[model samples]
Target: MITVSNLTKRYGSVHALGPVDLEIPRGGVTALIGPNGAGKSTMLTIIGRLLSGDSGRVEVGDLDVVTADSRELAKKLAILRQENHFVARLTVRQLVGLGRFPHSRGRMRPDDVEAVDLALEFLDLTPLQDRFLDELSGGQRQRAYVAMVLAQQTDYVLLDEPLNNLDMRHAVTMMRQLRRAADELGRTVVVVVHDVNFAAAYADLVVAMVDGRIAHVGPAREVITPYVLTEVFGTPVDVIEHRDRPVAVYYH
Candidate 1:
């Protein structure tokens, strides 16, 4: 499980995040949803240990996120930020192999190679394994980045806006893959997603943030309603049952 106690971040006098307390259970997908500048990414980056909070503590399972050894923590949690920039010209396989650095230390062992291959296959990037990242489409490159995170084989995975640049079909595929990782591999998946419908369909829990605070957190059916959606997004939203799931219709 992941626990946050009074987590807060500030940019000088501006409150970017909160003195928010949250508990995320183990072995399921939790979707963090909110409008722009709502601090969804801030909270995820803090939990993933990529960003620091002014006050509060975060623990991933038994490891203290703030104090845990960097190499050791890398083995426990893997994070994919919203923007990915590759400085070196690298192929899909090479990028995914970077995930094994904690274990392999830049020397690729047989097990590391196997792990990378498995992740590539999982993301259906095996066919493009030799291709350079710049050669792939935006959606394809996003898949490659996700594949790298999966190759880490960590118990906890945190992704920010993973559906960015993806078409509807690829977006659904990515969500399903994350769902499988949680259901079959017993990994804890926390993703920052904008679409309420996708969260409703795939996530076990939905966390809504507003003005750097967690507005609501509950099951999809409970959290993605018209009233909650309207309040969180500051727009009129209609929830309709589709295939027994709540789908948000918020178009103007």
Candidate 2:
């Protein structure tokens, strides 16, 4: 399990996040959802050890995030930020191969090559593996990036807004791919999503945050109600059941 205890962060006088505690069980997909500045990204970054908490402890499995060795942590968890920029132009295969660096240390053995190939195939990027990143459409590029993280072969994967700029079809496809990753690959995926409906449909657990604290955490059916969503987002919301799953409808 990923555990957070009394975590807090600050910037000058502004309290950005915390004194919050959360537990994310291993396996399945857990989504962090909330309004802007609700601290979803802040908490995720802290758990990934990309950002430090002012006080408190975070543990992924038995490894202490703050005190664990960098290489060891990388093997246990992989995180993709909102914006990824590569200075040197890289092929899709090359970007995915980078995930093997933690294990290969810049040397590509047969096993590492096999792993990269599997990730490429898993994301349906094998056909475009030789294409440069800039040559692909936005959705395809996003898939390549995700394939890179999957190639890392970690038990835990954290993504910040993987659906950021995609069209409706691409967004649905991305969510479906993530769902497949959790079900087929046995990965524990944690994502920060803006759309509550997406979280309801794809996430096994929905963690809703308000201000800098978590407002609710539970299965999608329990947390995606009009009362809870309206409270967390400060907007009127109506939830309707579609194909046995609750979907939030906020646009009137």
Candidate 3:
């Protein structure tokens, strides 16, 4: 399990995040949903060790995120930030191959190759493996980035705003693929998503944040209710059932 205790981040006197505690279980999809600047991204980045938090501890399994070795942490957890910038032009296959660096250290063995191939297949990017990242659409590029993270084969994966550039169909496909990654591959997936409906449909748990604090955390059916959502989003939300799942209707 991923555990957090009294985590906090500050800029001067302003609290960007924290004094927060959360525990994400070992093998399911957890979606963090909230308004802009609600600390979802801040918390995810801190957990992934890309950003440091002031005054608390974050543990992925038994390893302290603040103190773990970089290489060892890479093997234990893989994260894909919302904005990815690459100076060198790389093909889809080459990018995915980078995930194996923790194990192969730039010298890919058969197992690493197999892992890359499987990740490409999982993301439906096998056909585009040879294509340059610039050649693909935004959604396709997002998938490629996700494939790279998946290829790492880590026990925990944290994605920040993974649906940023995806269209409706691709967004659904992305959520389904994430769900599969958790169910079939037995990985713990934590994603920051703006769309509560998608979270309700795919996430095993929904963590609602407001102003740097987690307002609610529970199963989708329990947390996605109109009262909770409306309170979290600061807007009226109507709940409806579809496919035996609760979907929020906030856009009027």
> How would you encode candidate 2's per-residue C-alpha lDDT over 103-157 as one tens digit per residue?
9999999999999999999999999999999999999999999999999999999
Model 3, span 1-252: residue lDDT tens:
999999999878988897899999999999999999899999999999999998899999899998999999999999999999877899999999998999999999999999999999999999999999999999999999999999999999999999987899999999999999999999999999998999999999899999999999999999999999999999999999999999999888
Backbone steric clashes in candidate 3, count: 0
lDDT of each: 0.94, 0.95, 0.95
lDDT of 1 by residue, 135-248 (tens): 999988999999989899899999999998789999999999999989987889999998889999999999999999999999999999999999999999999999999999
- Ranking of candidates on TM-score, top first: 2, 3, 1
Cα distance off (Å), candidate 2, residue 17: 0.7
Give the TM-score of each candidate. Answer: 0.98, 0.99, 0.98
Clashing residue pairs found in predicted model 2: 7-19
- The residue pairs in collision within model 1 are none
- Model 2's alpha-carbon lDDT is 0.95
